[model samples]
Target: MEALNLNVENTSSKKVTKLPPKISPKHKRINVLEEYKKRNDNKVALNLVVVGHVDAGKSTLMGHLLYLLGEVNEKTMKKYERDSSKIGKSSFAYAWILDETGEERARGITMDIAITKFETEHRRFTLLDAPGHRDFIPNMISGAAQADVAILVIDSTTGEFEAGFEANGQTKEHALLVRSLGVQQLVVAINKLDVVSWSQDRFNEIITKLSPFLNQAGFKKDKVIYIPCSGLTGENLLKRSQNILEWYSGPTLFQQIDKFEPPIRLLDKPFRLSVSDFFKGGISGMGGITVAGKIEAGTIQIGDDVLVIPGGEYGVIKGLEANDESSKWAAAGDSILMTLSGLDILQLKVGSILCSVSHPVPVTSYILAQIVVFDIKVPITKGFPVILHRQSLNEPAIITKLVTILDKSTGEIVKKNPRCLPKASSATVEIKLTNRPVPFETYKENKELGRIMLRKGGETIAAGIIINILSYNS
Candidate 1:
């Protein structure tokens, strides 16, 4: 029977009902308001990325998800089959939504971000089916940069959880990149469950092996929901299959996906501003996100004193608007366009945070860090130029010390006295900023401001967080 409930609010306006004349008895019995409201309620959505070792079923899992949600029809499924022979696998699903160039499809690897939309029973999902190849992993990194949630699709048959047995396979680097990009939650989809012949043992094995890394990534045990299903068979997807393998009793992948919440910062402090996409709004102001962090204590208004230490430049607030409406006080997370009092249009640009002079402590020398050595082919040594970025600031710094290398797989210090960070590694290092007055948070409190990426030769080599710096006194 279709689920039934009563909602006082009318949903006729939200739902465009167009179904076949013949309806199921359950559909006929639904409480109109309840049913329609459920359908019309603004869905709680999180950007879920399907990533893992290449051919680890990232595409298949997404296709299955689309299929389960009934986003794609039977005709499309058949088309996938027809294209699979031509394209090598059901990658046509990836090609279909990703809109890859002909060469990209023929290669069966994602060269860039493939954004597509689909809806589930309870939530609308925006799936970013990213590339899983090593050479093209940068594109995946670019995609993960935008994802709110990450779904790592692993094939039990392949065996390696982070490292892969297959040549030209994907790696834990992919997972590390997702974490580095500030994705808050993870969902491991053990694809091709039928190939293992529905063996709970294999699923358990993958989970057992991945348990350590999952924990290291700061994800709760329950957060890693394992779905034992065949992307081929479409088992236990959208439908809340009650009696399927009674051993598993939690919500289906669909239900879990629907319930998963996107992580967003609650603007607790006043006027803790972050610059979103910014630009020139005349000879006057700049615009961007109320993207968490609020304005408080300091009375900031038109012609108010605004000093941005990020650029070591001062300006005045000529005006502020909450979206299109004129807002007297703009708090955190409100996209606003504001005019400047004295600064030129070139002064305040993107990634600049607005704050009072004494608000967030701006330091000359601070310890900025990362998980470190994410997919680094060479060793990261001291005195190297480390590219650091947080919120909207990206700059280069000299690595004062290697300090220590923490295991990326596990946050354990491998070396107390070290000089180089090796391949596929992580570490906690003490760093002195080449430039002063950068805003950073302790990783324990707010990750958005705490972390940074270390780059060299156009590639991001290591990423870590900012620890307190060694102060010099004469």
Candidate 2:
């Protein structure tokens, strides 16, 4: 399983040309970007991930927001309320919307990501409700990779803030992880502010404390904002409650979400979609397998021939849905559900990259990277074991060689062949995947696919970008 399929023609060594599918008179190739513009009026689409510490009420906050936005029906809300009451957890009625599994309900925790689609006045969103507990950081990383922005929900009740902000709190870790994964904009919702009677002092205190750390995590000051709200009572989510907090007036959380600037789409690049989830049956009676993922580069349309990398299985797109709406084509940054034909059920994997046949992503077992080490108890040495996380893929990898240690600011090598990398150090190292070769691009070629994180013992030890592919599978 660790070897790449060498039987298939190598795009590096051989020019693999893609043959256009024969079309009828009415089925001519349409400009996908122009068509997308015409369908959405002027609304922009983006992915949003919710992150916070355990018991921070992230699920309840998002679930209630969805209900307020009419994404969840009143009858369904009532059912959740009734069921939650029977379990003596009436307070978690809204949380039940996203935590649907019986195990999650019983444990009162979100273990896996729950995805939902909703729209605001000026934007359409694919909301990924990520787990907050430390045990599920890998799942959280998978969710954050697909997000354009993040909502960091912080519990504002007394003692709660300290516990989550200090000493192994996920609030700090989540912020760093999202920034490392390329999420730029962050909305820090000071959740449960009503628990302290909407005190502006408390809100300011939280901001004052978090501002420096967030800046250190690579989030620009202007790009980060704070909003006070009660997820339980639904205050300042859709509309600001009257006479609730006379000292402050600001946009609701929904309004702030709309203001987030969507990043530039990679429409001109070769088509690449990282597979997140797939199933056997197709949508709308289409007899093919459905694959779900965010398009990382270029554009994909019906009838486009795509090759799944690492396995080299071929498929043709038969149907597609973007942001929960049926569409003819989808571009980069759109969370898509695509139905594919001419593929084996066993060939497709969660981490496989689906790309244009002619311009396929390179499959490599070894890569050179520049990584920034995180705060850790022990230093990272050669042969260090780590689980390399890229998108949804987690492979066992090791630091085979430590090339050089670089100045954190200048990128100049301070020392060559250092003994070990200490905490907060920046270094260039060579990593080899112990599991199997995976489809990946250099950071210069594709930002989404290039960024990676190394986790060891349930902690994120370092984050880096693929600098170069040392060797490609022939």
Candidate 3:
């Protein structure tokens, strides 16, 4: 087995200089105390991702909830209704709110992660509606990797549940993937129950079969909440409908959202932001570029000098906005948009990590990882080529060595340098990226920075966590 390397040296050869903060025209200084007060008053921000198999009513459920919350007005709803009816797809009118793309609307499937913001009485949310189609699993993985909590929408219309929960369906794959990536709390919304006349027996039957599977996937029975709902008719969403569900007296979807415990923010760690999207121009034709992503750790203030890892590009924070509201500083867990100066647009791209220059994430080509293998026809062996996904970055990589295979039940070593890792097994292995180094941290230190997914031929093979960076390449 290769020993883990804990020490990392600064690999950049360029002269380090302290640059003055370059404030943008839209910049405004935020007082620390005032910011704290605002957070306390508004409650902590949370990123809630909705996931399930295709045609399971995820988009419709969320869109209707947003409409009930007045996030979508009657006028806009009328327009969606009229437009969808013209295409003979009136059932998709509610889904049109989150499925903005024409392709998504035409196909009636979520092809990519659709991000939108909403607020409840107690918490503000960044809702990520992930695609459920098998072809779009990579996109779904990207969205789930960023989520703090998840809402798994299950279809309850006769055989729809069985079809989605069976082998090759996305429900099982998505459930295991999110739990492996560290989503602790889940709300399983049994949607389309109205189709079965809100049958309690059907709901109970679904739960009886799924509980063990969810437990195996790492969700605690107590942490998993089951809610019966009708995304089409808007029952048990924002408000409960007593007429349909007279036997069950439980909290609505919004209430369950309010009960979610906010994750502890790593605000004191080194600032790390993964660039998810970037644009060429800034406000008012400003020369600077605008970068949008979530702050994974620590705090970033206006005019703070930032280093773009793997590229060694420097930029200054020209402006910052959290939840589409302008602000001076952004802390961990905030989805922010930042205007950056001092780097050309070509130097910045998706998967770029923005960090404070003094404590930037290490760039490495080789890493030691603890991986959980998913069910696949073939076992994973040494020198197996696969596609590696981290944050928004996806690259080709190979498993260089199978160090040790561990017991899936007790996590004890079963064999050293096992010949192959079979389905539903666990192991520690060395992975080597093919072309360039990536910015990564160990899972113990930073969850968002340390996670990765392995895929091959459009199938997700395994999910892994970085235990250590074994080697670095300049």
Best by lDDT: 2
Indicate whether candidate 2 or candidate 3 has the larger lDDT.
2
**Counting only residues 3 or more apart in sequence or on different chains, how many pairs clash (N, Cα, C under 3 Å) in candidate 2?**
1
- Count of backbone clashes, every candidate in sequence: 22, 1, 0
Q: Regarding TM-score, does 1 or 2 come out ahead? A: 2
RMSD of 3: 3.6
In terms of TM-score, how similar is model 2 to the real structure?
0.94
Worst 10 residues of 1 by lDDT: 1-10
Clashes of 3: 0
Q: Sorted by TM-score, highest first, which candidate order results?
A: 2, 3, 1
lDDT of each: 0.56, 0.87, 0.85
Per residue, candidate 2 scores C-alpha lDDT tens digits across 1-474 of: 001011212124222344434431244577987976776577888899999999899999999999999998999999999999999999899999899899999999999999988888888888999999999999999999999999999999999988998888888888889998998899999999989999999999999999998887778899998989998999999988678967768788999999988888888989999999999989899899999999999987888888888777778888899888898889999888999888897988889999988788888989888888888889999999999999999999999999999887667779999999999888889999998888888877888998899999998889988878888873
Q: What is candidate 1's local distance difference test score? A: 0.56
Q: What ranges in model 2 sit over 4 Å off?
A: 1-27
Top model by TM-score, which number?
Answer: 2
Error of 3 at 185 (Å): 0.8
